[model samples]
Target: MESPSDAPASAPSGTTPGLMGPATILPRCATGIEGLDNILEGGIPRGNMVLVAGSVGTGKTTLSLEFLVRGAERGERSLFISVTEASSKLIQNLSTFEFFRRDLIEQGSLVFVDLPVIYDRLGLGEEELTGEEIDILIRTIRDLVRSLGAQRLVLDSLTSVCYRIRKDEQIRDFMLRLGQELNELGCTSLLVSEIGPNPARYSLHGVEEAIVDGVILLWNTRRFGDILRVVQIVKMRGTSHSRAQYVLELTPIGILMAPHLKGGREGGP
Candidate 1:
């Protein structure tokens, strides 16, 4: 893995000369959140699977939506795969945000697919995902990406999928394979997960952290009698990122994260 600074200053074509010599530096995919990209240096390593772990009300979905919306604004096709909510409901919820554009959806620049609907389409019932079932799911997602030419993807709430798998090894295998498939499709992805109250765990299962290229933890802390949303970059491979916990704010337009201030818990919206 090449550090951001070690990456090539310029690339002529297929193979770019870097500090590592004759290596290709993957481009960065901006998350579209204010100040967050700067903290990440430029953006996440392109085609890397990133885990966005947070408990409820931590603005996990909002942040993921903003990532896709921002990518769409940049003319990058984005796909949101929802395992927890219907497409209509998700769209309805995002309707209030200034970044939520119905025109993008209409234009097919942004797309939403419910996982349950895909399962039903494939004639698979609600049960533990076997090897065959997992393959089908991966194929379905890959097909979607290929068809839409998607550059960014968000699998909202991977925790929901983990619940259906019975064995820990199966979950690990599933995540590994899923990440590889997504990477092969040349898409930067966010695997959103609902973390438990335990701050030590990055995801529902401990397997997710090891499978992804990055892990971002979002949580709320009580500071001076106010609930302050905080974001921490636990790990990001191939790029140097700020590890400090920053203040996260949900504004009318989108999320704005700033460095934590001393005794200023009431500053964020």
Candidate 2:
């Protein structure tokens, strides 16, 4: 069994003999999303906690859902923990995507869980979660992941959960413990962060972005009188990646990306 750690296994030593280079290449969890994998130079390092931050309608949820679907198709158990939306409604919306396969859910490879159910079961009904309550929450999440043998997970709208925690210290501690648990379980996770059109920080508490291993920021920009969706890799640890902004498209088949033409002004959703 993997030991609990705050981050993924450290990169190989520079002096290590290898045909690829000085160090052996790190293992990646391919997202299977068109341009995203390219931007990530294959995909995110396994066991990373990436923040998918964006305003409303920028496709944060769509991108995350696709990640889970692709993982499940690859025989990896995937889980979706919905905080702000109903799983049934999410399934309804997912049906429109051509790449989505309902059979994955039926086969038990993909699972959809509502956060409220966990909260109720744990008796975490207060507006603010106490320190002990937060510990319970983290333990429950870890237990669920372990029970499902999940290799990939998504927490839709992490901002909603942070709102209840309120204090920055607690929020930071929560993320740290939760991330460690997931990393130890070998689960690559995406925590959706809902922000405004132009935000100073990617997360609600401004501390979450610092705790995660990566940040993928999405937004809408106006170019030639048309609003185009844009994606940029603000930060990714444990591996090198392209930080350039790209144009993103949401279609029935799935998301597509192209290099941004530039000269576009930022716009609100």
Candidate 3:
């Protein structure tokens, strides 16, 4: 978690301007995650790719699901592309949440795609993704976005894909192409990535941080004999965001985040 003091001054000079200057305010898409929008000064920039990187059990999946579910409630079509979990299992896990609605899925307002199913269809084996394989993956995503007219998208666990790509340059190229495709399709995306415990790096390959428009890091830290979950807006290009870490909680309703208070910690029951 970055301290608020670490953030670049919004008004560095009266004359000299910065990315957060008055003329550079980008359009925002409200995430509907409690306290998160407030921290982001409304929401993430529209059409921007955001990386939700974290270790296991840090609420990355829940957070992404809640984002799609909230968008569905607003009549915005959303697509969830799962690389690790099957669509059935994903839905089953999220079924207990109050925000989860069968009607949304039935209406096709919320759609899910299992990447492994696509992989099998393409006959891709357990090897590094060649240029052709990467192209196939990107095309599949593009076709889904167009067919559904998806306004928001979530790619759950890009870490799985990273494992299949052996080269750093290949991963970087894939991300660049994928980001461009999503932007052109006008879909705001959340790319979930699994990071290792106590990571000095925010992403699996250390390349995603540079490819996306924003990086939101989630992690757990032991404090006073209790494991505390924290959410931090590591970097949000062309947007003003809170640099301080916030305590995150996963409830029956959805995930909630709040500013971390001095000498106190917060977590789910």
lDDT of 2 by residue, 128-223 (tens): 889999999899999999999999999997999998998899999999999999999989999999999989999998999999999999998876
Backbone collision count in every prediction?
0, 0, 0
Better of 2 and 3 by lDDT: 2
Distance (Å) between predicted and true CA of 96, model 2?
Answer: 0.6
Please give, for residues 55-134, the per-residue lDDT of candidate 3 as tens digits: 98999999999989988887778899999888999999999898899999999999999988889998988788888998
Stretches of candidate 1 exceeding 4 Å from the true structure: 1-25, 262-269
Q: How close is candidate 1 to the true structure, as a TM-score?
A: 0.88
- Regions more than 4 Å wrong, model 2: 1-22, 263-269
lDDT of candidate 1 over 160-206, digit per residue (tens):
98888778888888888888888887788999989765557787778
Lowest lDDT block of 10, candidate 1:
1-10
* Strongest candidate by TM-score: 2
Model 3 C-alpha RMSD vs. true structure (Å) is 7.0
Scored against the true structure, residue 261 in model 3 reaches a CA lDDT of: 65
